[model samples]
Target: MDDKEMLFNSGILTEEREGAILPPEELWKNKKGGLVVVECPQRIPCNPCATSCPTGAIRPFSDINDTPSVDHSKCTGCTLCVASCPGLACFVIDLTFSDDLALYKLPYEMLPLPVKGEKVLCLDREGKCIAEGTVENITQPRKDRTYVIHVSAPKNLVREFRAIRVVK
Candidate 1:
């Protein structure tokens, strides 16, 4: 099978694969303030996420090929894993960023990237619009090709929204 088919059928980013990669809601609630959820399911020989973690919080004790499992207690929300991940599957969600707003950090590699303070359409895992989110921050180091976008959304949609699109 072709790579696209493989990816869409059962790869790490597939809907079926989300359950295997995403942590439970209880875990997120318990962690509350700072934690990362790496939705990486299919293990096809990659470890950039683990390698870029400065705190060694992204499965520091596991094998290179092992899917990243965030040690929430140890994670500092550094976001290195999000930018370094080859598949752009890594994400950092801060549920306690505010009383009614949550922060979502995602890897964006699109043209005319949204700037901080820009309003964008928040999307779910399947790319469906769920709500409107504000672009709180955009961090793109010269050395990194992937841009990290920090978006603020309603607390209720924290788990439902996974991506964003340009306002236009």
Candidate 2:
């Protein structure tokens, strides 16, 4: 199958996909403030998410290929795992940041990075534009090229929008 087809079928998240792959809604609901969600589907040999987490939020596994299961109660939403994830499948969501909005943070490696307060297009898992989101913050260290972008969108779109596009 082509890359696009693979993305559409296996990687892209939907209600059905979330039900099958993601932790239950109660898990996410219990941690209403903030937490990390690992959308890693394929069981590749990766353990950076578990290794990078200083809080031990990601459960340990005997095999490096084991998919990460988050201990949301322990995750500080520090975003260390988000950058460490090679697949760029990790995300941090803050539901209590504001009454009207939720903060979404993800790995952004694209060039021509957007600045704080810049408006960008929020995209769903399928890369379809769903909402106009504002760039709240961008943290990029000289050592890490994969910048972490924090965006704020409607609270309802927290699960719907997983990415952002900066127009040149």
Candidate 3:
């Protein structure tokens, strides 16, 4: 099956879909604080990601059903869109955190939120644990109840790391 077909059959994003939405190579390679990565490939009627952006990094959609497009240059990586997105497709990756580690700000809505400095099992897009990560921080600027979990894991796993499970 084609990448798009596989994505529809299973919720997991194919490499092709992921590559299409990624920021430019130069921006990904050099940006410091963080960069928003929108994984919403389907042209669904969603605009919260674009509207919630404080820096207008996520450009206004020409059509309501159009997929989000980011002007990486304008993105401050504020992560406001992370909680606003209903599909949970938004993530902020900070590669400059350390030489060996990268920080990921992921949307978490599950019960019993993980605390700061807690150890968590870093899971991939498939929800499989691939590595252990440390919870650097947790922020909820709005009372929407969606918490943004800041997880720091090995820099090499930045692309694979997505969600976290509190280590028991």
Candidate 4:
């Protein structure tokens, strides 16, 4: 099953089945400029996303089941959470990079992945491609399903891209 499916079956999220997050417009608008909001889908056994952080950005707060916290102040926009999160809930956002744009980093698990500078379609949380973007960066593949891809697109598309699509 996909991550969404697993999250639903595990009963960790309160949203409708397969839906784990609220609208960014409601949950994160006008918040801290660089704060990255993460939706913890479930309370499954995992804490690497918290411990793997070098700057202590991911807050453990003395509980393994607690959701991880990324302090944007010290995040450095590192992709460590992309590689460390067993559930793939982490993402990085840079709002100041462009006046009308934002950079997003997401965990990619599909095959025939994208490369740097390659133009690809950007999808939202529902897996719908809503914008075109250039792959500005990609994290090296490790022993897990985690791989972070950085995409640059128009500012409005910033909230729409939750996934990446390689152009045919």
Best by TM-score: 3
Better of 1 and 2 by TM-score: 2
RMSD of each: 3.9, 3.4, 1.3, 5.4
How far in Å is the alpha carbon of 78 misplaced in model 2?
A: 0.4
Using all chains and alpha carbons, the TM-scores for the candidates as numbered come to 0.80, 0.85, 0.94, 0.71
Report the C-alpha lDDT of model 3 over 1-168, residue by residue, as the tens digit: 987789988989977677777777688766787899889878888899998898889999889999888899998778899888989899999888888888999999987988888999999999999999999999994576478999999988866788888866
Q: List the lowest-lDDT window of 10 residues for candidate 1.
A: 10-19
Could you say which candidate leads in lDDT?
3
Candidate that beats the other on TM-score, 1 or 4, i.e. the better one: 1
Off by over 4 Å in 3: none
Q: For model 1, how does the per-residue alpha-carbon lDDT over 1-168 read when each residue is reduced to its tens digit?
A: 665576758542544455555555666655654467787665667998888888777776366678777766677777778888878878888877788888898888888999878999999877889999999999863265688899999878755677889975
Looking at model 4, report the run of 10 residues with the lowest lDDT sum: 14-23
lDDT for each candidate structure:
0.76, 0.78, 0.87, 0.66
In model 3, the clashing pairs are: none
